[model samples]
Target: MAESDSDSGNLAQVRHVVLVLSGKGGVGKSTMTTELALALRHAGKKVGILDVDLCGPSIPRMLSVGRPEVHQCDGGWVPIYTDSEQTLALMSIGFMLENPDDAVVWRGPKKTALIGQFVTDVAWGELDVLLVDTPPGTSDEHLAVVEKLKKKHHVDGAVLITTPQAVSTGDVRREITFCKKTGIRILGIVENMSGFVCPHCSECSNIFSQGGGEELAKLTASPFLGRVPLDPQLATSLEQGQDFVRLFPHSATYSSITTITQTLLRSLEAA
Candidate 1:
């Protein structure tokens, strides 16, 4: 479902929308979403994150802004802004929970309705790009979001995340099939946790089997974006909700993220 043009086929107001998905968990999918948003913001593009991982929304915590006030206006529900410049905005069901430890115990129909509202009812204002982060597997929420994105938004494509391991890529393969079936264009594959970078001496170590994500991309005929190495500093920044690329411009992980984001931008412009 490659967009014929950005203008004609896009959603009412957004310039582009990218869904960040990984078939399996623990592959740094959420972290990748956070990094890409920061990178896009750094490039001066207006961006927002719609954390559709309903049961476990981490965008607020990862952004370190906490649950913000959702103001009602003449148009609709206004999303929470994370920065002073207001270039970044966020909307998530997690913000609606009464307690952090409480679970999102809802049935299929309810989940779908909430997701639809997040897409159509929320006052996203104007956005250059809206990155949606989903839960690990392709389930009810994935289908609901895909349906809404098809009917309501002009999606740029999907950014699939995976680690360098057969087990992880195997699950991500199913995610690719899900995208194909749903008419969601696949932008590329991001190989996260490709390798480990030693903090003390900056030495590289292949703690996990390498190149599975690249191999998967090759097999699926998708563009191989780039790989993000495992770094302690990057993890700490994610935990602290600090901008890793902003604070660690010279680090390896930052370099990979910047390159991958550049690739996505180029792909979008060409499309």
Candidate 2:
């Protein structure tokens, strides 16, 4: 039997936890998570992206879901399933608050409890992969999720996301260090917004210094997942609450994300 199975019960019974993280914000990490989930679904994987960024949750908007009805189930709250019927469970603090704009002012313990409920109390059923989209910076929420999963639940690995910029790259290094301290495996690094592809000319321009993510991966000894260029069509779709993978499948942006998905599957197989 595999060591993972020997330690984690039946291999088939354990869910693959792929934590999608970024050292800072505005690097398109959440958007990458959304597209990755869609690409995995396209490739026939029962996947779900858990939006844990309480202060600024984007999964609902990415999936075009409005305020979903949440109620007690058995012992806890039930996650809202997307319209695709693929059972993509969503648990975010945005759903529980009385007002969406209200601030989530809590200390470490409260944040930890909320994260615990999100993981244990919610009915995720069975998932092939749970892509956890964490918030920017090493906050209480981020620490809570990593600690809970590492000490309690079975976390398969983590995928770091960053832009091809010096600041983001620097931040990713810290994220890798944090993972090292927590014993969570660093699966790979995704270089998002590596460049901007000009559709009319089919040319790619380095909007941000390119290859920073790959360099970080090399420095940290993690796999370089792939790079996603900045595509305006993607931005437009996102503004209108549409996902590029599902809405613009034939676009260049979608192709970039598809490549990332392929690389991700290969990493999982290698693991």
Candidate 3:
């Protein structure tokens, strides 16, 4: 386990709890969560990320965050903050495993219990928003996060991520219904990896077949945030442990997702 720290404050100070979701795995939901968090922080908002993915926590790696110490504060267990001008307060089950390769082989009830602990135990301090990166589908992890966050604080809404393919979008559409049934607002739907660009010619290609996301949004009557092209720069930035928006401010992927994140902020404010 990582080191622990202490702080003071309840989760009520957090204005919005944003849940990031996907229909299935490999849709880049975690990447979206990390980038969106950084974008919001770069805009001067206090942000925190709770990686409830548990079995497949990836926020720490994408953000280049090392094992953080968990501390106790007046309110509860304090999470570790990133070492940056706009530090991102983060908490993840990954920090608790004895080794990075350790597998979390727990069942549903146990997963639920751990999620409850994350919601009530960690000291998030006062945050404008807390972004939750959930595992794929509306499974146990998703249910636990929504149930616990709402029980402990106001969950603003959900942002569903999907690739530009039926296989991906098909699953993500169900998340919208899940939000509706649970009374969680549908902030919007994001079409990620909609296309790819040839590094040599600067031309974009639809390798995975595009437009399924936009079509699904229309069919479901949900807000289509925008489509993020598969820019080579994005992967490189992530590999280099750099913020995509900060490093590739003018890329299509940056422009597309930033707009969506801004729209999300507006929705949170209105909530």
Candidate 4:
């Protein structure tokens, strides 16, 4: 027999709430968040992806959800899922706007209100994990979510992403500081764009000056999750709204990402 409808409509009991963030832009934080969600789902866990990058949302494009069908029920709003059918409860402003390019211009208070609705009003349904894809930088939106989540719920932990660069690592350090002040525990660090692998020679090259994130994790005493090498195919796959984890499970980059997912699961399980 099929499961009950109520079982698929609420996520308050989700075991883990993971915030995927980066210190800077262009570090593939969004991509990492999506892939990690897909990875967890592939591992037999129900997951949700919340793109809180209000001003520059990307989950819709990455997941090919396009504009979602919004509806009002009771006193709150309900978020729509994607056509990919990953069983993910996806929420993003892109789903509400007539066009994905519409701008979200609001101050801190207003932003906070919108996020409140994003959290309280939307029907998240059931989930094993809720992956929040925050915007780059430590902006008002980022702070609001952190503050709100901390006040409202016991967040499982954070999965910080960073590329292999000094500037990127520096920003990530500040993120660590913020997390410290907010009492959020660091789950681990995933070093994205760690290097590039040559198809011809099967050799790895330090395209973004490797190991910056690993070095920072060492400095901060956080676990170095794993390294995701740069893959040209991944860019194309993400653009086409495909789950790289499912589509390229045997690829080197996907294997590394899977390792990071395992680290996360292990920590959660032990906790």
Error of 1 at 155 (Å): 1.5
- Measured by C-alpha RMSD in angstroms, how accurate is candidate 2? 2.9
Model 2 stretches with alpha carbons more than 4 Å out:
1-14
lDDT of 1 at 217: 94
Off by over 4 Å in 3: 1-9
At residue 50, give the lDDT of candidate 2. 70
Q: Kindly report which residue stretches of model 4 are placed more than 4 angstroms away from their true locations once superposed.
A: 1-11, 83-86, 199-202
Across 136-219, the per-residue lDDT of candidate 4 in tens digits comes to 888888888876665545577788999888999999999898788878889999889888877667577986698899999999
Error of 4 at 172 (Å): 0.5
Per-model C-alpha RMSD: 2.7, 2.9, 4.5, 4.3
**Which rank order by lDDT, best down to worst?**
1, 3, 4, 2
- Encode model 3's per-residue lDDT on 97-121: one tens digit a residue: 8899999999999999999888888
* True-structure lDDT of candidate 2: 0.78
Pairs of colliding residues, candidate 3: 3-69, 3-70, 4-70, 4-71, 5-70, 5-71, 5-72, 6-72, 7-73, 77-123
| Candidate 3 to truth, TM | 0.93
In Å, residue 26's CA in model 2 sits off its true spot by 1.2
Give the Cα-based TM-score of candidate 2 against the true structure.
Answer: 0.90
> Per-model C-alpha lDDT, please?
0.87, 0.78, 0.82, 0.81
lDDT of 1 by residue, 57-81 (tens): 8878889988766788765788888
Measured on C-alpha atoms, candidate 1 has an lDDT of 0.87
